[model samples]
Target: MMRASVLLISCVLAVAGCSREPAAPEAPAAVQADPAAVAAELDALLAEWHESELKANPIFATALGDLRYNDQLPDMFSASYRAEQEARERDFLARVQGLDRNALSGQHRLSYDIFIADRESSLAGNRFPAWMLPVNQFGNYGSFMAQLGSGQGLQPFKEVRHYDDFLARIARFPVLNDSAIANMREGIAAGVVQPVPVVEKAIPQFGAHAVDDVEQSVFWGPIRNMPADFPEAERERLTAAYREAIANTLVPAYAKMRDFLRDEYLPKARTGVGQMHLPDGKAWYAHNVRVNTTTDLTPEEIHQFGLEEVARILAEMNAVREQVGFKGDLPAFFEHLGTDDQFYFKTEEEALQAYRDVQQKINPRLEQLFDIFPKADYEVRPVEAFRAASEAGASYQSPSPDGSRPGVFYLNTHNLRAQPNFLVETLSIHEASPGHHFQISIQQEVESLPAFRRFGGYTAYSEGWALYAESLGKEMGLFTDPYQWYGRLSDEQLRAMRLVVDTGLHYYGWDRQQAIDYMLANSSMAESDVIAEVERYIVIPGQALAYKVGQRVIRELRNEAEAELGEKFDVRAFHRQVLVDGALPMGVLQTKIREWIAAEKAKAGA
Candidate 1:
């Protein structure tokens, strides 16, 4: 999943202002006459639309390499701001619709469809009161703000202006915290509060930022590592400023949020894990399923799909057990995989080195399957200490569009046993080389696409591609070890289980323990990992459903293409078609692939 940093920033900035950023000095004049002029007009509109987004959420802007609004923080959660965002989306939708779609072809038509769909989805979401229940275990603004203030997240702290910009941004945290508190209270009044367990998890996250000594805080990171090249006078000035900001403003803001969560919100938080517990929750969950998966598949349909997938994968697991001559059933094999010291690393460095080894093995073979590669580089790093325990086993952060920052695949080494050596190759593929890093970096570097298509994403397309990438192990010649092959199945099983447990928790009214039990019974995941994953589903309903749903569509598309095209099918070209336009909704992706298949067939015949 994409980290909460960009989303949190957008949510916060929604309430800050409604004005568009100042127009570019040589902005295109409004379209007047010709059909060709319509294309230019659409391009100009999208550029303006993207600029407005950056202006509203400066942190998102920074992540995309647009430094124009780095110092700003918008009040994104207020009712007035939401109304403005809604209005702005409506305006953009109207302008996009007014374009001459009949006059456009190829990429221009695809852009038009995607732009319209994106705006409509945004407008449709206003029906749900997501603003009221903002803070949750997985992605509360409190945690995201701390990450930004720590100077290691998207907010830059390099030059003096970068430092000053962050100081300006951090100064606004108290206001954002006040808004979050107010929103939570409103959630309580409206019967839209988070689950009790999820809210409790966030309390500790807030306290991590609310430190007693400013110097000991995560926010003290930039100051501790200040550049030696800085002038002594400027260094002293920033030091004093940072100390004051952390001690007085940032720390107090976090304490207020922590205290509110503990004292006020926690008491009123709903005990039920499902969204069905909230007012209009049933419909809300259905909407979220549609949004995340970009499909009309209902929870019941998805639940059944999960059941079928789990059974199929379990049968494969049994095959692996028999191959290894394990003298036991499937559950016993799971136990062995989880407990055997041979499958685990003894130290953090060992685990890190194992992942590095996987990278070396896979890098050389990537060109055989994919012709287009991302220019932006990537690296492997340990998950930051503060959030490591609660974080997923691995996640990827995309590279900066300008290539200043390499995409990082953060491995969680909080528990060495959970970082099993068997899982290293699959995890590396999913989070780095053929997964997020490849998809996202290619999107950012594709200058032909509009800004939204480049940076924007459909959850299903992105996550599904990663899951599909994991399935390429044998073909790529890396999963030669039986344990490594089992690792791929285990990873696939996790996505399959997400289909079952996420829907179970939200749709079937299964409690947290019920979700946890289902995961434990179905997969070989460590108990701590299972608990974290379950809590993640509880807090972020419908998101987990995207992985399997997306992967299924992409894999199906590839199979159909290979069958129809026969010897004419080029895996390299097939991959390029899917990724060249960045992430599309599954339907759009299918259309694009079908078109490519037809064109390939025509070429072969000619």
Candidate 2:
């Protein structure tokens, strides 16, 4: 799983005259008097918007290797913040409306469209009270705070000021926590509560932060690992300050959040798991589907498509079973695969080593399929124990743009059974190497693109590209073993199952148990793994659907490109065209590729 960008759907870019101008403009025109002037104005607007966004979302800035706002934290769940954001979007739209996007050419025109699309999508989402349903099984802002403060995430602790920056940030956690509770209270009254299981899973996560022993807390990490270069006075003062901050601010705030969830929120949370359970939930889910898939496919269509994919992939898995000489039907073979120790790892170290080994073997082989690579490298690590239980089987965090941080591929070691031995190659290909680390890092490294394009993404394009990369394992001279090929099928089947289960839960009124049962019967996943995945889709609707939806579109485009160009079709060139501009909406990607195919055809005739 790729870590989500905090800036909504795409980058919420703005036309900045609203901030810099003496007065708001009356209305926008379809065309401006000057096209060159509009392009220059847009460059200024994008730069201003980038700085404004980074300042508004300090955590995101820190993650991106920008530290100008390291000492700050926003009250993201507050009503004032909501109003301010809405006004900002309206202001931006108004400003953009004043510009002549059609008059611009090339990337300037594309940027203008994406900027408007993001602002419009964000404005549309304001109808749903997301702030009311902030805390879920996956930690929200409060959890993000803990990740940065732990000194093991994006926040650096090398210098004394780094410690001070954290201290400044942690002091504000109470306000954010109080605002979250306030939002939840309003949500409860408005009937926009999270589901019971989501709250139940979250209750323990909140309590974990308020441990009685401050020294033993995750927040104490930076203090423990304080650099030796610090002056004795600075270190002592920082230690005392951290001790006070953790005991006074963080612990009590967390305890209050824990008590609120356990006593107040849990009782009020709805029993149903679907987003469809809330007011205007169906529309809200449709909005999410549009945001996640970046397409207009309805739930019914996606659900049926998933069913077909499940059957097709199952046939492939059965082919592998035959190759291995297993005497069983598909369902029986699934049971056997889950039960057989040969398919399982003995230790966490062994599983981690398996992923690491794939990295070493595949790194040199990537040249066969691609010509470009990221300047920043990536490392493999176990998922942090605190959040690993609720986390995916594996996830990737992008490296800092300045190369201060290497990308991290976190393999969940919470359950060895969940991390099957056969999955290392396929999973590795998805999370690291030519998957997220490559896509994200390369985008960041491209200095010519706008900051928003460098950092922002469409889920379908990025996730689809990763899944397509998994299919490339065969072309790369890997997946040589039949079981390794089965692993690819297993991963594909998981995405296909998501399309079915996500829609079933949200659109068709399927219960939690029914979704879990669908996954278990359809795939060889362990029950624990199956439950985790179902619950993941429960908390985050429409996200799981991105993988298969994106993969199918990307694969279709590649196939078409191959057919159009024939023997002249260069796989490496096709990949460059897909990846060169960072993530784009699927429709936009299709147009771009078709135009490229036309150009290639013209070149052949000439």
Candidate 3:
């Protein structure tokens, strides 16, 4: 949710008669705002904004384990609501940019910078009509609700209140879903709509929920998993309420949307797969590039950089191929890795277990890499069946701040071939243990930082860090097997390909198949994985660019640190410095590491 703004409070004494008003107290001498005073004000602004954000999107709040707003689902797509959010963003930018950041230092200064940047980015992005085309194959409110409605998501099913909370939200789903229709209509009038293919992908997903039987709906999951301690009457009563709600409200909502998309939206959906076809698309994609990568690098620069990285990584892959004595070219080696029976699991259980196996392997290796660890634990789970078809290969969900929930690494087992054996260790390291779960758990656990920094993310920093973590596999001695090393290269190749394919789609006007073919030719990825990845870049532009862009900057910083610090360059210390602060923009991150290196060098002289 975009944060709202608050004005500083004013207090004035007014209990005096007009003529008998006491002489004003002597004016204080003019001086800079005290550092602590500025920090307090900035902290106040951030705290209030975070609270407002939670309230604005109650589901977001609920996902973070804040139960106060679980029952509310605001009309986020309505024009009035959008205008109000834009106003709030402008107001926050005014208040935060008004702060005397020069007087502040350390965490306070960083907070001020991040807050101002966030507000500015949000406001700048308001020019783009992202709200119009909200739902896609990837996700939107509809699919997200399914995740929450199911018992497995962050929403608790422990008590009666929880059920009621979800019931209220469910009743409001029609409002939100209809608003999605209204927004798409508005988009249609404006010549802005999701690509034809991605919209078609969402049909079955929403259609799956439009069932006649209330028991069959995902919303019935909590009722099925109800606690044993509940009295029979309460169960019966709650079950009836759920039945009525699901049958009348929720299923009807899904059906309405499924029909609308099939009958209404699809005919009007744009044929061009890239944002460049939209109004002001060039500048719009530029904004995405600037924001996602957190650098001024253009689409062209990122595309070329991706090409370079792909070449470099492929060279290393060829070395691994030769070492393994594979009598084939790199593409042939990629084919072998893709089709060979030894490279894939036979069943979903084996696929999931492969990910689970990585945790045990890395547990002992972590001590060699770093001193810091998150207090919150993480679990490996499969992506739920309903939306898994469109979900990414693997993703990590952060633990609740209250520690009620641990971080989750959701591996998509929709296609077992996509979940290959060789890639297990690399993917696990990227999405689980020292990748997202590790970085995010460390971030949320840092209580001294403001709530926004703890929970908010900069994509380039976080995803870049995760991509960088994949490289650490070799450093930690985990990439012993040549096949595992190839897996690392393959995964890195995916990020590298993203930098190319994302730019090619949005900036170069490449069609969907062109992007897909490019990825297939470049990496050892399954065709299914390649298609999903390409479509992901289509729906969400410039996001894929972040992984390679972020990883490059971070790796450059590390290389520079190792070079300058020499014997003093402890990898553990370097890891601490990077992870200690939550995710930072690539530029801020570079400056930070340089300062760390200078400080460490000063220590050598001292």
Candidate 4:
């Protein structure tokens, strides 16, 4: 199984984001120093940065198929490790600052800016006690490790040595689990713990792995699915080793964590849902707002933006209702759409098939809009039963860069009633084609970019691009059905509501119930899904804000480009410009698009 130590590092690296200013005019095509020399230095620095990261967090390396550190697990929550990371970031920032920004141009300049911002953001985030409050319902290490061990995730078990590598990693789980307990204990003392409701949900998640039988354990998945090519004696020996590891090492580690969470952690977990309750929580949430959205907009500003968007989207929803002749008010229409049997699937297979059908319908039409398609293929799968109840309606996982593993679009089939027909088109568009899979795979396949640029992401850019991709359904001749169009509006409405409820929970001190009530009033989402989403926002402050914020910026940029370029506007080129360089901060993205617009205009005049 992959260690939580690496999972934490990956999350930190992933959760990891910039600035406000009108973008400056593109620099003159002049070089103050040898561009090659500057590029070489930048390359060296990025290599050093990646090497240090791999050493500090090896599990992340394994996830990327870098197997050199597969046998190691670092205690990333340790104070000393955090201090080391902070100092390293500071040193890199200094080295980057010493570079001549004026001497770098084009992609090199962009890389310089992104690298500096990344380091600065990393250092700035250290003020919050994120380590102390480690585990949550949304992103607990226990669940992630289970996924890894289930023979379905990133951990490979093809060879006997691979089995040995996993055993070595599994043996370290107890130490990591103990560290989590220690960290949560410190969080309790510091009054910086997860919400009681969220933590309560996690207790069962931990218990799911604490099975009494070795054969029944999720960790025994590798043994159950062992390669058939293995010699009989070797297979038997490996099976015995795995069984012992599960019975002695894995089960005990899970039991320890489950008991610690139930008997000790729950009593101390805070009832308050907002980040505001913790020391410096207001500032911490504010920082997260900036980081996640890659914007300077304050919570109050985002709340108001959400309100305006909600009102506007509701107006569109009303139009859809009138078009469909629903013969009721907007709220009534929401209820009808949600509860009406016609809109829902009868079985899990029907739901899964619906998504597969969407894939077939949409694939041939992609060429009409996109000139640059991802080489990586993707598959649609049902979200695993263990974590599906709490997972989102749909999500995308990027493909491995080498194409060894196809990207996965996990549709939550836990509740068939929640899987409405209208959602199939928009959900497929957003999570699969021309959405995350399209954007992320293309980024990963771009061999010219540095590893950090290829792998690193800004949530706003990624989620925003996915959300923006939803808007393309109309252009693509999908969403022709009024109800499907309403589904698009509903998806957008959820994002708009997030702008309100996420800020409402973390900034304005709204309770979990308040957020739920507001969502129930605003959209057609089921109460259970609404509750799960609200709790998700509660635990993961500032994350939900990315979707709408990112989409809004991209839309504004596209509108600006279309207006400025008029006859010159090319959708294919515009998309290529937005996606070609991988995930960038919103501001940086805007700057690049503006520069592209200028260059295109210049070409038109020429």
Candidate 5:
């Protein structure tokens, strides 16, 4: 029951920049300067921002599972929406910039930095026409909302009014779908259309949503699963309304969008792989890099890091190949490992079942490594069929703050081949066990952190920890099988490749073919998986860099703690220190851990 909120992942960041060491403390403010005033201002601003943003992107409101503005669909792809976002960001930035940072203490400083960094990064990204490249086969807004209106995905069917709101929302779909089409058209002319394969994959998704009858739609989940306690009259009314909404609004809107994309948009869509072919392509990518990484590291730096990591991982894979008695060069061995039918699940259901099995296997082991655990339970489910193709191999959705729902680890069985048996261990570790499931749910459940810190996150810090967790397979006693060990290497190698391919396409001027070729030649990835991954890098720049970069930092921090504290160091304590603070910019995270390490050292001395 997590709210339908936007998942705003952003740029890499540098370690903490130096500030003049706390100048001599000033006189204490009278009565501690009324914390209430600051609290009130922040709450008001946050509420206003949410309302305005929801008004501008009603789909966002709906996604948060908020129905207050369900009937409306903002012109998100329009110039007006972009302009308004700019103004809002600038206004908020100016207001916060004027805040007395020095006067703030403890959690207040964290709030200020989180708010400022988020808005500043967003504003920095404004130059990019991200809106134009709107309709992807993945988790883009257009398709997401279609599911919402169809009454299937996140939309609820509790009461008669809820049914009416669902209908009202679907009625607004034509406008939203039209906007997506228009934006895609604009992208086509600008040569920023998604890759051909990705777009082709998108056609069916749009086509399916464009079904002619509401009764045949996925939105009928409510009707099929209606609560038994509901009165007979209410049930009938809801069933009819749901059908009417999907028929009148949902089907027509989808058909129009599907037709436009297939007939009008796709034909004109450019075949270029990178944004560099688009208007302001170079500048657009640069902005994306800055925003996503939260750092000034040029694409060149990330690309080079990727190259080095790939080499390092290849050596590790060679070690595994040696251990497993494979007789061939590394690349040849990789192909064997990737294509072997025994390595893959025979059916999608089998693939999903395998993941559930891992959850059972992992939970017992997790107790050995950690003192803390999330109160929220988690489930292993397949990613919805509609969006699975373009989605990541696997992902975890955090639970609601109030614990109304459990965390969900969605395994993308869209391509069963992608969910090979070897990858199950790595994917489970990353998406469930100590990776996203643990980190996110723990953060959400933390009562000590601010609401923003508990719920807000950074891709590098969050994803970095997840990727790092995959490296702990042996430490957790699960990488006993050499093939599973190879799977761990494969997953790491993929992340390492992201570091290279993403930067190659965005910064180093490598063509799409070059990036694809590099992945094919280097890793044990299927072509379908490789294509989806590279396209992900293209659309979401710098995100690929966070995995390896963040993991490296965490690994290094652990090493430092172990070296510094020797036998006194505790892995569980180290992990708790990292997670308890919630997600921070990597730099802040480093500082906090170092402070903990020093404190432990001091305590040992005492």
Candidate 6:
């Protein structure tokens, strides 16, 4: 919920005195606003947006269920394409300006603000040509195409035509790669190359898909597991086309791109970890910080805030360490958790089974806390073997809007040592249960919400809510085991430490290894996990700051309510108010909570 505009005591006094003196003859009332008209305008704008956007980024459109442009892949790295996307955003902003926001209700107004702000932010970002460096190892179109063509990802596999269309899409890989190479060359000239580490890490990932025979590539997933209902003739044709497309196009393209990065791009890549280190680094990072955090807080301010938060969470962690009968200090306990086989699963299957077990165990207990829950069912699945090492310990993929698929909680079992028994409860809560599952699925099911707000999200609000749910593990009665409770503390500490480490590396000149060492020393983290996390920070700066900072504000808001309302506070109602209007800025969330508190107090007075 967007916060109500702040009300001053002087404004209240002014209104009270004005009400007393209101004896003048009333002028003719202005035209009454129609909610339906406002909605019609919104609908028109949304359709126009979908059309304009799909025409510009057809791949993204297909990913999001818009199939009209299914066969046409945009030259995403083209200069003209970038300019056109910016123009589209400006037009959307202008078109929506004609609508009377005050005529709409609260939710519609919020949708308007979020949409406008996002576009305006995108426009602000247009100054930087991120399109020029589109195909990094982290998530390049090269790899994504394989995933799409593999018949197992987002591309529909129900129909054989779907399979044929995907193969046609895969055939365009070399054109896309040529465009990407041209774009990166431009980046080199502009001094806008990605960090050396990102490029270095990406080379092997590309090589993984670049195989001796494309016919036997990961993209063969569909060919291997064709729908049993398909006619044998159709299936055979698809399998042959898929094999030819993969072997001829995808495999060669991946090898070409991988070799280019290794032999051409890697040596030219800048050693700097930050956008600030690039030619226009300072401006680039500033725009990114604002966009990612959705606040105007400077990197400098966030850095300082993170430092303070690290100090605070450190004290809490130390207190937990002492309670657990650790003979050594907090650092020793961290090392113990990192290295001990006793804390780890014996195999990858065991680790995945543990998460599935958590799914069954927590569902019944969740009802005790949430009066409202997402109707979408979710299942626990292991990370695909290809990307597991690079992935987070556990991550969630939200359900399709139509509910054909349940939300998926992907657990990474790449290195089983990183999958600790102690942290399972906290991980489940953060990735599933009252964490992402609650916040995301609820927003999607909100019928009154506009399409964008229902589908789109802010990292701070989304990740912050998940971290906050981790704190609720004890409240919901799941952290009964001391080791599990310690796991909760450890995970909480990791987020708290992210506040420090992310800001440290990006803003304060801390080395990559420095960030990794700090996390390993402070929390029970495996070195592999620490390396992946530090690299994640290097590529995507300021994102790690969201979880803890957002969580802190939310907790402060709740504490204020509990204190002010005393015995009258309703936890469920408070959560409903936070979630019901969808995600909002931290400032907006604060305002909404204050409004709820005042309304509750007024009701008590009556």
Which candidate gets the maximum TM-score versus the true structure? Answer: 2
What's the TM for model 2?
0.95
lDDT of 3 by residue, 1-606 (tens): 011111110011011111123335546875657888888898899899889889887877987898999888888988888988888888888998787756677878767766766776777788899888978988767888988989898788899888888889888888889899999999999998999999899888899899878888888999999999988988999999999999999899999999999999999999999999999999989888887877778888989988998899889999998999999898998889899999899988888877777888887899898899888887889899889888898887888877789888898999988988988889989887788888888988888989888887878888888989998998788889888888889899888888899999999999999999988888888899888888888998887887887888889999999999998889999999999998777767777888899999999989
The TM-score between candidate 3 and the true structure equals 0.94
lDDT of candidate 6 at residue 50, scale 0 to 100: 57
- Report the C-alpha lDDT of model 2 over 289-377, residue by residue, as the tens digit: 88888777899999999999999998899999899998989888888889889998999899999999999999999898888888998
Please give, for residues 1-606, the per-residue lDDT of candidate 4 as tens digits: 000010011112211212323245567984356767877898888888888887887877777778888877677777877888888889888997787665576777777777777776777788888999778887788888888788887777888888888888888878888888899999889888888898888888888877888888888889999999999998999899888888888888878888888898889888779999889989999888888888778999999999999999999999999998889898899889888999999988899899999999999998888899898899988887778878778887777788888888888899877778889999999999889889989998998898878878888888899999999998999999998998999999999999999999999999999999999998899998898899889887888998998899999999999999999899988999999999888777877788889899999999
Which of the predicted structures, 1 or 6, would earn the higher TM-score when compared with the native?
A: 1
Residue-level lDDT of model 1, residues 277-382, one tens digit each, is 8888888888788778877788999999999999999999889999999998999999998999988889888888888888888889999899999998788888
Superposing every Cα of model 5 onto the true structure, what RMSD results?
Answer: 3.5
Question: What lDDT score is found at residue 306 in candidate 5?
Answer: 84
Estimate TM-scores for all models: 0.94, 0.95, 0.94, 0.94, 0.90, 0.91
Cα lDDT tens digits, model 6, 50-107, are 5676678676566556667777776677777777877788888888866765566555
CA RMSD, predictions in order: 6.2, 4.4, 7.0, 4.4, 3.5, 5.1
- RMSD, candidate 1, Å: 6.2
Clash count in backbone of candidate 2:
0
In Å, residue 353's CA in model 3 sits off its true spot by: 1.3
Give the Cα error of residue 459 in candidate 3, in Å. 0.6
Is 4 or 5 the stronger prediction by lDDT? 4
- Best of the two (2, 4) by lDDT: 2
